[model samples]
Target: VYADNDPIVLVHAQTLLNSSAEGRTAYIRADVNEPDTILRSPGLIETLDLTKPVALSLNALMHFVTDAQDAHGIVRRLMGALPSGSALALSHCTPDFDPQTWQKVTDIYHRAGTPVRFRDKAAVADFFTGLDLIEPGIVVGHRWRPSAEDGGAAGEDGGAAGEDGGAAGEDGPAPSDADVSLWVGVGIKP
Candidate 1:
């Protein structure tokens, strides 16, 4: 469920569908605020199986939601509807490190008509209150168990292993175990 109010994305989706004769794809023109409308849509309902475990991905979207809307509440509502064993994959921008740069980026979004509300590590963790975190726990995007070939430490830097060879402290401790612009984690409903 890719919810974006971008006309260009919709246009591209349409083109992809038209070009792919063997595969099946459909695009819904709506906003994330109206989740019920999306769930009731004929195509969405038919394509997704609510009874099975589904991966709810909210990458780079939560920051757009404000306090009044309760971004965490929105996530809980969607998770409640999914069956046990469902997984949630999320990545969100935070202000823990490089507050100045974060603010600049946020201001840019605001000027573009899509204002962003950044959260800290704790606030971001609240969104996954009821789910069980996967191994290595919640960490930055890159530190979440990278491939051995990547040649980087696992988990956020600066704790113990990071003392030897890791990114400098100017960026504040790599957030979790990776070097990413935001926090990322995967959780499973049990």
Candidate 2:
């Protein structure tokens, strides 16, 4: 299932998914804040079995939702609608590592009218309340379950930037706190 508030994005995603498979894919032009729209979408109902476990992934999407929008509440509501065994996989931007730098980035996003709220580890973890956190709980986006081909500095292969990875340029080595500015995790609803 694919959904987006932008009609164009929904159409585009639908086109791509429809081409790959028929009748197995559905795209809904809806907003995440409105849990009912997504949960009650006829297209989604036809494609996904609501009674079964569903894996909901929200990657780099929550930051776009500000406090005024009650981002956390919206997430909780969405998850509450799913089955007990449903899973939530998410990655959120955080300013815990380098507040100064992340603040600048947040300011830039605000200037562009797309305000981003960089939450700390604790704040991000709050979204997973009542759910059983998977292995590696909430950690830097790159540090969560790193793989051999991982592109971040935490990767066993020395990362994509060739050892001197991360935003600190060579001053601070890879796998540093400041380098990983996003928290990632997966949780299952009890």
Candidate 3:
């Protein structure tokens, strides 16, 4: 199941994302601040099997959730509800790399009445505290699991050997790391 609180994005996603014959694609109007509401939602409960491993992806979302909303706690709660072997894939905006530029962006968000918090690497990494991270832990968005042709991240083994051409940016994707200014990683619950 996919969840998004933004009505506009939800509408767009509904039009674009569809279910396949073998599996179903479900969507829910959910807020990251309300873990309990999302966890208990009928759509999610009905579509997903909580007993088995479920992939929870939070791409480019958590940065909007400030510390007061318990960003990490919300993730822990969501992960806590699922059984072992569940996976978490997250990508968050960070000010660690181009701090001046990101801070200006944060100011813009604030001016628009939308509070934003661009976390540093340490804070972003905290989101995966209890899970075991995969290779190239918590690197910039595009650098994570790049196609073998791109040579992967700085020190990656470049072993996307059998990767089905679907790896992120398969056909020459992304700009510099500082340009992206986001942290991404995938972790599996033991």
Please, what is the TM-score per model?
Answer: 0.80, 0.83, 0.86
Look at candidate 3 and give me any clashing residue pairs. Answer: none
The sequence of per-residue lDDT tens digits that candidate 1 reaches over residues 1-190 is 4545689998887766542455445577777666666667776676667898988888888898887777887888778888999998988988776788788888898899986788888888898899998866666565566543444444344122453333334446433432355778889999
Best candidate according to TM-score = 3
Displacement of residue 51 (Cα, Å) in model 2 is 0.7
lDDT, residue 99, model 2: 93
Q: Residue 48 error for model 1, in Å?
A: 1.1
Per-residue alpha-carbon lDDT of model 2 for 31-72, expressed as tens digits?
987878998999899888889999999999998888899989
Quantify all predictions' global Cα lDDT against the true fold.
0.72, 0.80, 0.82
Model 1 spans > 4 angstroms off: 17-24, 153-179
- How do all the candidates rank in terms of lDDT, highest first? 3, 2, 1
Residue 185 deviation, candidate 2, in Å? Answer: 0.5
Deviation in Å, model 2, residue 156 alpha carbon = 15
Instruction: Give the better candidate number (1 or 2) by TM-score.
Output: 2
Count clashing residue pairs in model 2: 0
